[model samples]
Each structure stands twice: as C-alpha cells, then as structure tokens.
Target: MHRLLFALDPEEAHELTLRVLSLWSERGPLLEVPARLLRVEDPRLQVEALGLRFPNPLGLAAGMDKDARALGAWWALGFGFAEVGTLTPRPQEGNPRPRLFRLVEDRALINRMGFNNRGAEEVARRLWRFRERGLAFPVGVNLGKNRDTPLERAAEDYLRALQALEPYGDYFVLNVSSPNTPGLRTLQEGPFLDELLSQLRPATPKPLLLKVAPDLSWEALDQVVELCRKHGLEGLVAVNTTLERPGLQSPWAREAGGLSGRPLKGKALEVLRHLSRVEGLTLVSVGGVEGPEDVWERLKLGARLVQVYTGLVYGGPLFPRRVLKGLLKLMEAEGVRRLEEVWPPIP
Candidate 1:
C-alpha cells in the first residue's frame, strides 16, 4: 500500500495523501489504536520546552499539515507536539505542480513548495475551531512570507500572520530558512534578521522560535544566536532541510529544492552541536532524524526537543511513537530519568 503511494508522481502522491488524510479527519483519530507497534508509556520521557510541557520530546515537524486541518488525528497518533504550516499572510498556489519529489534510493525528498497555504486567517480560524473542540496536544504555527512579497516587507507578512494566528497556537516558528521561497534564507543574515525580528518578536507573547537552515557557517550561527538573545526569543529549531547534496544516491538528488532525510544527518548534527554552545538558547533539533538513535544523538549533542517530517513520511504513521519508544529504551539502558538529562552540560 505504501509502496503504491510512493510510486505515483510526487504531486499525484500528495493529492492522494491529502484525500486519504481528509478521510481520516472526517472519521477522526482512532484513540484505541493501541501502542501495539509504537510505545506510549514512558514516564522518564516527559519534557518541557518552549514554555510548554510535552508528553515526550518527539514532535511532528511542519509541512506535514500545512493547513491545520488534521490536528486531532495527528495528536491521536501520539506526537508530543505538531507544528503546522509555513502559512503566509495570504493564500498561494506555491511554485507549481511537481514541486515535491521523493528520492527513495537515499530516503530523502526535495521540495520547492514555496510556502503554499490557505493563508493565515483561514488557518487561524480552523485552529480556533480545533481548539474550541479540543486539540490533543500542543500545535505550533510555522510562519512564512508570500513568495512575491519583497524581502524588505517580509516582517510585515510574518507579523500579520503572527497577529492573526496568535490566539490559536501554543508557539510560533519563524521560518526564515525554507529554500523554496526566494530570498527567504537570506533573512538568516544578522542585519536582515535583526530588522525582521525587531519588528515581529515583541508583538507576540507566545514562545517565538527561529527555524534556521543547516548550511549556515559558524559565524552566521553565532550572529543568529546574538539576534535571538537580543530579541528575547524563546528558542531555535536548529537546522532546517539542507540544499547540499554531498552523498545522495537518488536520481532526484539534483532536484532544485531543499533536501531532507537521512542524507542530512551529519551536517544537521554538527549544526546542533555548534548551536548548543550558545548559552540560554533552547534548541529543537530537526533534519535527518530517522529513529531513536538519531533522537538520542541529538539530545546528547544539545537538543531540548526534536521534530521529524521526512522521517515520518518514510517510516509511516507510527514513526514518532516508535522513535519515542526507542528513546525510552535508550534512556533506560543509560540510566537517564528525564529527557532533559540527555542534554550535554554547557561548557
């Protein structure tokens, strides 16, 4: 069944996925689904990050549910948190058809999605409805500027999305790293980043997290840490998908988009280690995290929490819970009590 899903063209596969997801939403999450293959009972796995308590440290990363439409089903799947959207101030069709490609040979994906979303207002409206009924866990909103929006006015777009969706989300992710959007990653520059965050950060009380690209230099990472500290932001989602293709085996490796999955493991871990050195910054490690070993490795390096998107897509519905279970086994073996203890002490 899953193989058939992957066999189709990326766009067709995505549409089929959406249709299947819509059906699941209508039926709602199966609470009694049981942790048959996935683990859900680990006392030592509870964690608190980004001003919110998570039942466990593993979360569903952004881009999985771009419209906030499947909060109930995902939460039921046992994720500690679910970050939704790269939603813009207005709706966009995104780049074009075939923007998403799977590199099965390398267990990766390349997507130039261009932040396509139902616009922030609609996203907020649906989120409000979800909350009104009740969401099973914390849901963070990922904000981005529209593609045609000029870089100078990007903050305006982010602020608009933030202000409009503020009441709906438990947290916010400033997605200045998605390579699909033109000039988006440039916002990582110290001056441009400061300009944007200065305008948008103070307006929201929710824990604001900056999502950065994995390909940043040490100097750039240092500057971003300084900027976040200056703005009084809560944390950073260290290392979004990378554009580099060093050891890729997939034919789609040359695709014109950010590459994510196992291929990104080494560089993403390095970035996590570097960012971990920054005092007083909580880091949510993302990119190339495939299993419990990957999660444990990130925590050892310096991640307060971890998020997975590509891994889930490749590993199927039980990925997050399976990873969490494996994390519990690792913790038990290592005599660790809490996920926080897995973090390396600041030197």
Candidate 2:
C-alpha cells in the first residue's frame, strides 16, 4: 500500500493524499472516531507555549497541507498541532513541476515548491470553516512573500497575509527562509530582517515567530535572535530546510532546493542548540525530526515545540502516534512527571 505512494511522483502522491484527507476533514465527528484509536490523549503530552496550549509538541510543519485541506485529518492522525502555508498575499503557480524530490537512500527530500499556496484570503476562508468545527488542535499560519514580490517590499506581503490570516491561527510564523523564493533567504540579514520584524511585530497580537535557515552562519543566526528580541517577537521556528547537500547519497541531491529529513538532523540540532540558549524565545525545531527521541532531544535542547515534514512523507500516517508513544516511554525512563517539567529549554 505504501509502496504505491512511494512509486508515484512526490507531488502527485502528496496531492492525492491531500485530496483524500480533505474529504475526510469534512466528516466532522467522524474524524474523532478515528481519533479515539489514533490520538494518544495523555495529559503528559500536553504543552503550553506561545500563550496557547498544544495537545503535544509534535506538529505537522508548513508546506505539507499548504491550503489547510487536511486539518481535521491531521488531528485524527494525532498531531498535536499543524502549521500550514508559506502563503502569500496573492496565489502563485510556484516553481515548475518535478520540483519536489525524494531521497529514499538518505531518508530525505528536496523541495523547491516555492510558496505555491492558494493565497491568504482563500486559505483564510477554509480556516474559518475549520475553526467552526471547534477542535482543540492548534493551527499555525506560516506567512511568506510571493515569488515575484520585491525583497524590499516583502514586509508588505507578510503584513497583508497576516491581516487575512490573523483572526484564525493560534500563532503566526514569518517564513523568510524558504530557498525556493528568489532573494527570500536574504530577509534573514541584519538590516532586512530587522526591518521585516519591525513591520510585522506590530501587525498582530497573536504569537508571531521567525523561521530561520539551517545554512546560516552563527553570527547571522545571532543577528536574527537579536532582531527578534529587538522587535519584541515571540519565538522562532529553528532551522528550515538547508540548501547545502552535505554527504547525500541520492541522485536527487543535485536538485536545487532545500534538503530535509535525516540529512538535516545535525544542522537542525546544531542550530536548535544555539538558538535554544537565548533568553526568551520559544524555539520550534524542524528540519529532520523523525522519531520519538528526536522530539525529546529538541525539547531538551530548548525547543518548546517541534515540527515535522519529510519524516511524515516517509513514516506514513501512523508516525505521530508511534512517536508520541515512544516519547512517553522515554519520559517514564527519565522519571519526568510531566512534559513541561522536562522542557524548561535546557541549557
């Protein structure tokens, strides 16, 4: 069954899966019927962060269900939260097809699937309906500029998208680090980031975070931390996919895009370890969180929450439950009485 999906073109498989889940999302209480079997509703897994409560630390990262199509399905799959979109103010075609690649040998993926989302307003409408369901799942909106937006005016794109999405999301993420968008990564620089954060911080009272790149220099990373603080932003989603393809075995390694999954574990952890040390920011670790131990490590390293993308593509729908169960075992071994007690963002 899984082999059929793996055999299909990555994007095709993704769309096919989303279509099925989108239908399932419309099922209302039926979604919870599966939740009874799939969701591991332990009080120990509850997490409080960004002034909102999450059922667990595990989240479906942005770029997966870009249109908020499978939200109810995600909750049924047992993800504590989900972040959708790298949405722009306007819809886009994104980079041409065959833009997403799978690296099975490396348990990884490479995607330059630009910010190809159905614009903010359309997605907001979908979210509004999802909100009416009143599920406890926390959804995050990750905002980005359109492919054609000038780097100088990128803040305008984010601001407009935020205005459309603000009332819906539990939190909002500024996704300036996606490599597929030309000049997008430059938004991480000192002045540009400072300006971007300055403009966006005042836009919403919702929890706002900056998602950073895995390939950044330590100094550049620190510059981002300082600017986030300077702007009074909430926290960060550490280490988005990396452009550097270090020691990859797949032929897809040559593809021009950000590489994620196990290949990104070290760099993601490295960045998380660094950013987690900062005084106040809540770090949401992404990049390559595959299994239960991966989430535990991120929590220990200072990530108040963690997100997964490539891992899900390879691990299948039951991945969330498996990891959540494994996490419980680890917690029991560590004698952790509660998830919150174990994750004070260890130095």
Candidate 3:
C-alpha cells in the first residue's frame, strides 16, 4: 500500500489517501479491522495538556488533514489527537502543481504547499459536524494566513480564522513557521509576532500554541520563548519543517520548501531540548519522530505531547499503535507507571 501510494505524484497520493480515510471515517464497518489492529489503549499513556486529556501522547500533526476531513478516523488509527488545517480566512489553491516531493532515500518529504485548504468557514462546518457526531479524541486547528493576504495585515487573516474555528477546536495553533508562505516566517520576529498574538489572544478561548520554524537561531528562539511567556500563550509546537537540507542522500534534496521526517529529527530535537529549559511553557515536539524510542525520548526530553506527519507517510497506518505499545514496554522496563513519571527520573 505504501509503495503503491509512493508511485503516484505526492499530492495526488495524499488526496487519494485522504479520500480512503474519509470513507472509513464515515462508515464504521470499514474501520473495524484497522482499528482493532491499530488501536492501543492504556491508562498509563494518557496525557493531560492544554486542558484536554489525550488518550495517548501521540498526535497526527497539522497538514495531514489540512481541511479537517478525517478527524473521525485518527483515533481509530491510534493517534490520540489530530490537528487539522493551516486553514486561512478564505479558500486557496495553494502553490502550483508538483509542489510536494518525496525524498525516498532520505525518508523525508519537502512540500511548498502554500496552506491549501477549503477555507475557515468551510472547515469550521466540518469541525462542527465532527463535534455533533462526537469526536473520539482531542482536535486542534492550525491557523494560517491566506496566500494573498498582505504580510502587514496577516493578523487580520489569522484573527478571522480563529474566530470562525475557535468554538470547535480543543486548542489553536498559530502557524507562523511554515516556509511556503512568502513572508510568513518573518512574523516570528519582534513587533509582528507581538501584534499578531495581541490581537488573537483575548479572542482565543482555547489554549493557544505557536508553531515555530526549525531554522531559528538560539537567540531568536529565546526571544520566541520569552514572548510566548509574556503573551500568556499556552504552549509551543517546537520546530515546524526546516528549510535546511544538510547531508541528504536523495536527489530530491535540492527541491525547494520545508524538509520534514528523518532529516528534520536532529534539529527538531535540538530545538525541543532548548525549549525544555524554559520554566512555564508547554512543548509539543514534531519532526523526524518515527517510532516508539523517538516518542519516549521526546517525552523524557520534556515534550508534553508529540506529533507526526512524515512518519505516517513512511510508517503506514499502524505506526501510532506501534509507538504507543513500544512506549508501554519501555515504561515496564523502567518500572514506571505513567509517562510523566518516566520523565525527570530520580538520580
């Protein structure tokens, strides 16, 4: 299944995969076999963050279900939470075709998909339907600005999306980190960040998290951490996709856009380690995480929650269950009963 999907254009494969998952979500019988094979339940894996309880610490990261199409299928696939969208105030066609590439050898993906989605109003409707049907796990909405929105007025776009979707999401992610949108990463800096957060903070009833880029300097990261604290934000989704392509073996290495998967693991971990030192901020780690050891390491390193995107492309549907089960074994070996207890171990 994975190889066949890989044979098609990356974006087409993605859409086709979503359609299958959406069908499974809409019909119970279709999910039975996969759910039994994939779902791993353990009280010890429960994690409480941002005022919501995750059945497990693992999540399906943003970009996978950008329009909230498969919210119902995620838990069946073993993810404890699912974040949807990079949804803008309005619909967008995103970047031109062939914008998504797979670096097979590197076990990574590079995409310049510029926040393609069905718009906030449309996605909010889907979210409401999911809610009406009863979501099985926590869901977050990742907010992004429209492609044509002026960088100066970017806050207005995010504010619009936030207002429309806030009632439906368990939490909200302000996505200023994606490299595909022109001038979007710039919003991570001083006044622009402050202005955007200031405008959205009061209106956001749910916990607000800022997703940041992996390419930030230590100094810039410090500023972001401080600003997050100062602004009363709930948490940080450490390290979005990276623009750097260091020591990659695939021919697709030179392709433009943010690089995710194994190539991003090292830097994403470094950024998470740095953020762990900050006293009050919650950290959700993403990037390069593929299996149980990676999830365990991130939790020990101080990530309250961990998310995956590219890992799913390579690891198949049962990946989350495998990771969760692996975590249980690790916990048993260490004689710890809870994920939180495994972290900051006694010396």
Candidate 4:
C-alpha cells in the first residue's frame, strides 16, 4: 500500500489516503480492533497542556488534514491529538500543481502548498460535523492568510479564521512561518507580530500558539519568544519547514519550497531547547521525528508535546502506536512514570 501510494503524484496520493481514513471514520467502530491493539494506555502518557488533556504526547501535525476531513480516523489511528489546516479566511487554489515532492532517499518531503483548503467557513462546518459525533481527542486549527492578502492586512485574515473556527478547536495556531507564502515569514518580526497578536489575542477564547520558522537566528528567535510571552501566547511550535537545504542526495533537492524531515531534526531540536528555557510557554517539538526514540528525545529536551507529519508519510499508520509503545519502554527503563519527569532540569 505504501509503495503504491508513493508511486503516485504526492498530492493525489495524499487525497487517496484521506479517502481511506474517511472510510474508517464512517465505519467508526471498525477501527476499534486496531486501536485496541495499538493504543498505549499509560497514565504517564497523558499530557495536560493548553488547559486540555492529551491521551499521549504525540499528535498529527497541521497540513496533513487541512480540511478536517478525518478527525475521527486520526483519533482511531492512535494519535493523541490532531492539528487541521493552515486554513485561510478564503479558499485558495494554492501554488501550481507539482508543489509537493518526496525525497525518498532522505525520508523527507518538500512542499510549497500555499494554504490550499476549502476556506474557514467550510473547515468550521466540517469541524461542527465531526464534533456533533464527538471528537475522541484534542484538535487544533492552524490558521493562515490567503496568498493574495497583503502583508499590511494579514492580521484580518487570521482574525477572520479565528472567529470562524474557535468554537470547534481545542487550540489555535497563528501560522506566520510557512515559507511558501509571499512575505508570510515577515510576520515573525516584532512589530508585525505584535500588531497581529494584539488584535487577535484579546478576542481569542482558546490557547493561542505561534508557529515559527526554523531558519531564524538565535537573535530573531529570542525576539519571537519574547513577543509571544508579552502577548500572552500559550505555546510555540518550533521549526516549520526550512528554506535552507543542507546536504542532499536527491535530484529534486534544488526545488524551491520548505524542506521537512531528517534535515530539520537538528535545528528543530536546537530551537526547542532554546524555547524550553523560557518560563510560561509550552513548546511543541516538530520536524525530523521518526520513531519512539525521537519522541523520547524531544520529551527529554523539554517539548511538552511532539507533532509528526513527514514522519507519518514514512512510518505509515502503525507508526504512532509503535512510538507510544517505545515511549512506554523508555519510561519504564528510566524509572519515570510521567512525561513531566522526563525533561532534564533547565540550567
């Protein structure tokens, strides 16, 4: 199944995969057998962050289920939480086709998919439908501005999305970090960030998080961290797909877009470690996490939660379950029962 899916166009293959998950969602209880076998039910895996409880620390990252199509399936797949979207106030066609690429040798993906979705209203409706049936775990909405929206008016786009989806989301992510959108990363600068956050923060009912680019320097990152703190932001998702392409063995490596997967792990971890030093912020570690060991390392490094997207593409449906089991083993071996005890004391 994995091999066949990989052979098709990346976006098309992704759609087909979603369809499969949607089937599982419709059937509902059909997933119970798999869930029972795969779920790791340790009290230690339960995580309380952003005023909500996650059955485990691992979650599906944004961009995977952009439209909230299979919320139930993600829960059944054993993910503790799922972030849907990069959804905009208005629906976008996104960048031209062939925007998503796979570097199989590197176990990575590079995508310039510019927040393509059915728009905020559609996503909110989908969330409502999912919620009517009841959500099994926490869900976050990753908000983005439309491509044509000017930088000066960007906050309006985010505010609009926040208003539309707030009722259904457990948390909200203000995504100013995606490299594919024109001038989107500029929002990370202090003045723009402050302006954006100031407008939305007061009105936001849920825990608001800032998703930042990994390419930022320590100085730039410091500014962002401080800004998030000043604005009363609750959490940060360290390291979106990077613009910088390090050593690469794939022919498609030169293609333009953000690079995610193993290459991002080191930088993502570095950023996570930096953010963990600050008090009053929950850090969500993403990028290059592939297995139980990676999840364990992120926990020890001070990530309150870990998210996986590219890893899911490479690791398959059973991946999250395997990681949870691996986490259980690591926890037992270390003689720690709770995720809070896993982190090393900040120096």
| Top lDDT hit | 2
Question: What's the lDDT of the predicted structure labeled candidate 3?
Answer: 0.90
Q: Highest TM-score, which number?
A: 2
Model 2 ranges off by over 4 Å? 345-347
- After best superposition, candidate 3 residue 227: deviation in angstroms? 1.1
Model 4 per-residue lDDT tens digits across residues 1-347: 98899889999999999999988876757876676777767788998888889999999999999999888888887999999999999999999989999998888899999888999999999899888986568999999999999999999999999999999999999999999999999999999999999998997768999999999999999999999888899989987999988897888899899999998899998888888788888889999999999999988888889999999999898998899999999989999878877765332
lDDT tens per residue, model 3, 1-347: 87899889999999999998888888766666667777898899998778888999999999999998887789788899999989999999999988999998999999999999999999999989889976568998999999888989999999999999989999999999999999999999988999998888889768999999999999998998888888899899987999999899998899899999998999999998888788777789999999999999999899999999999999987788888999999989989898868555211
| RMSD to truth, every model | 2.0, 1.3, 2.0, 1.6
Which digits, one per residue and each the tens of the lDDT, describe model 2 over residues 1-347?
A: 56799999999999999999999989978887888999999999999899999999999999999999999999999999999998999999899988999999999999989988899999999999999988999999999998888998999999999999999999999998998999999999998998898889999999999998988899988888999988988899988889888898998889999999998999999998888669888889998889999999988887888899999999998999999999999999999968889765422
lDDT of 2 at 328: 96
Candidate 4: clashing pairs of residues = none
TM-score of each: 0.94, 0.98, 0.97, 0.97
Better of 1 and 2 by lDDT: 2
**TM-score of candidate 1 to 2 decimals:** 0.94
Judged by whole-model lDDT over C-alpha atoms, candidate 4 comes out at: 0.90
Regions more than 4 Å wrong, model 1: 26-39, 344-347
**Per-residue lDDT for 208-279 in model 1, tens only?**
989999888889888999999999888899778888997888877888988988888888888887887787
Q: Is candidate 1 or candidate 2 better by TM-score?
A: 2
- Which residue pairs collide, candidate 1? none
